[model samples]
Target: MTRPLALLALLVPVFTAAQPVAEAPVALDGTHQVDLVSEVNGHPYRLYIAPPEGYAADDTTRYPVLYILDGRRTFPAAVTARAFQDIYDGLDEVILVGIGNGEQTFDAWFSHRWRDYTPSANAATDSVVAVQFSQDPETVVSGGGPDFLRVLREEILPLVDSAYRTTGDRGLTGQSLGGLFAAYVLFEAPGLFQRVGINSPSLWWSDGETFATEVAFAEAHAALPAHVFLSVGSEEGRSMVPPMERLAEALRSRGYDGLTMDAVVFADETHTSVVPAMMSRTLRVLYGRSE
Candidate 1:
């Protein structure tokens, strides 16, 4: 099995990534890009800005910015999967900014994502299922998510807001570890984003009781009102589904005065296949435009 296949194999209900699926291709239609170098708390980050298709200086229109994790892959794929041209054919536009690795992604995202997403890394005690990527397999530098988030807020978000015509209505997206981070941000900083799209989050990574974190957050923040979309591939890892359902129910009980939580299980999508599927839905749900 390929490395990706090996990763997905750990997940059950297996929609194998080995097979091909039909998806429409994207045409650039004159892409505009700007490479930016920025810093947050003294750490430097690289940013790639993909302006709206058919962009014009005189348009002067403010658009919703989509902040995508795993930008090395997701940014281009999402731009195409969402059928960029078709979605913005008539309606307003959006800015696609791909934030790449800062020094090291595995260390940066893995360690920090856990710290930011999970209520506590010490919460897990189970041994029946092993959560891959839970520990720093090599460097022993883990749990720095709060710092990563600071990079986004202080460095990335401000750059996009000032450099592009932004409406301040941002959408955050991630898959697996990234998904966990997205959900974490939602509960911890409810007002930071208007919408969040999470795909195949490793809910069971911390423990079977990750829902407790959300429940606790709701108890503390009475007015947490943000739209949330959660998805896990039916064929994903063994622990993906049950925890997803648990989280949905937790949100239901917590009550978000204006919260909209959607949990999706794609029967034919494994952990790997679900990325594109999630991106497709995320575009429609957040942007209000579908191809």
Candidate 2:
């Protein structure tokens, strides 16, 4: 209490500077990243998971989680687009998990997806068409849909649910072949996901095999208890629109009151360039945020 004048003067600057430096709060945007790795059916998968803001504070709160195929390249845009939806339109925020095909480069991803997303093509027929020198009737390096679906249903979904605050509802998003896989899932394992976004699905795959399957599937089930969003870019090609329309028509004809469907073709958009807008619209639509 009896400090000298010199000591008292020195303590003033120390006290001011010691006030925690008043750092600028960092202005965090409330985002976090987590890596989930697991082995499924002899293949290893790395999933990038982003839980929405306020995920951790309440133990009782749960949100729907979306599973994205081709997640390595697409997850960034998907999450950002969802964020924009949340900010601008007050959309319900959910968890985003992208399943990457383990390819860090472009070419590898193409080949890898062909093997994982397409339905199993007959080896005998493939040999004949492949010999034509014109082209193989069978898809190249294709036919792995069943196994990949197994991975999603058995391994990925369970693990993600255990780790994150996910609710009973689930959503799926994919493009092209991945979209084809989503289409197959709509029939093969309809109960797995409540919302599905199929973008420019390669209905051309396996010589349009999915069309026949869709017809059969709709015939069997009068009302599918799920929401479906189908999208294709106007400039993709003539063939793209018809198959998608046909599938939509097939589903609608079922007269299933539980089924909700929306099909749109964004004008002036091409295959490669359509993902961003499609992904954004998909989030808004399937997540019930669309105006």
Candidate 3:
């Protein structure tokens, strides 16, 4: 019996090894890529668009759009999370538009994101980030956020609207520096997006310039008619957590009519580890079906 068992194990290994291998990876369904150039900044962008399951060009049903920042790293996660939420939690379906810089290397991607996401150029903040990443401060150039926003408004939005059937209900989500950019947009042009998700934002940028932006917005505008979801990891440290909580508090204290804001701190999660949970929760909060 022992000899037969040994022979069966060897046969099992041989059989498993004999199985055919796939020639190529299976692509995600209903997903397509679009390469576009930003007329505002002259930067090229790659959009990874994932339409909802069962989407069709001939179908007259229009869907909402969710623009995701850091598309290269976050797109797949967003797509998977959205699909699962829709399947299991009865979440509403929306088109996912991931904006990527088309960088092949991590260093190139890092530099490009730093340039586009920051609201202002600060040599002091640049030096700190440079040291953290082992990069030279001179190599990191920021202050392109305004232009990037223009690229989104004048270029990307039009392209997306023209290419797809959309309901004009827009959502924007980002993490870290991307989150910082989202916050900038929320204050700079609150009307652009109906839903905003800020996850682990680097509010420490430019000495908390985003707070000043918020103050300015609140001064001029009586109400902000948007759904804002703010979240952070409990382990993201004082620099991230306290500032985010402060922002939440400030927004709450304003008593802005028509503004629905929710802030959450996920325990046992770090900045890098909390992304999936944050994304999932953001979608549920912002787009969950009404009971």
Query: lDDT score of model 3?
Result: 0.90
Question: Where does model 2 exceed 4 Å of error?
Answer: 1-40, 122-140
What candidate 1 gets wrong by more than 4 Å, as runs, is: 1-44, 84-92, 102-136
- lDDT per residue, candidate 1, 93-112, as tens digits? 67776665543456565443
Candidate 3 colliding pairs: none
What lDDT would candidate 2 get against the real structure?
Answer: 0.79
C-alpha lDDT (0 to 100) for residue 207 of candidate 1: 59
| Candidate 2: tens digits of C-alpha lDDT, residues 1-291 | 557887899988987886555667331255434444445557567787778865775578989999999988788888788777677665676888888856766556765676678877546644653465344344445577888888888888898888877898999989987888899999889778999999988887667899888778777877688889999998889768677777878777778758899999988999889999889888888885545
Candidate 2 RMSD to the real structure: 10.2
Is 1 or 2 the stronger prediction by TM-score?
A: 2
Candidates in descending lDDT order? 3, 2, 1
TM-score of model 3 (CA atoms):
0.92
- The predicted structure with the larger TM-score, 2 or 3, is 3
In candidate 1, where is summed lDDT lowest over 10 consecutive residues?
Answer: 121-130
- lDDT (tens digit, per residue) of candidate 3 on 210-244: 99999989899998989999999999999999999
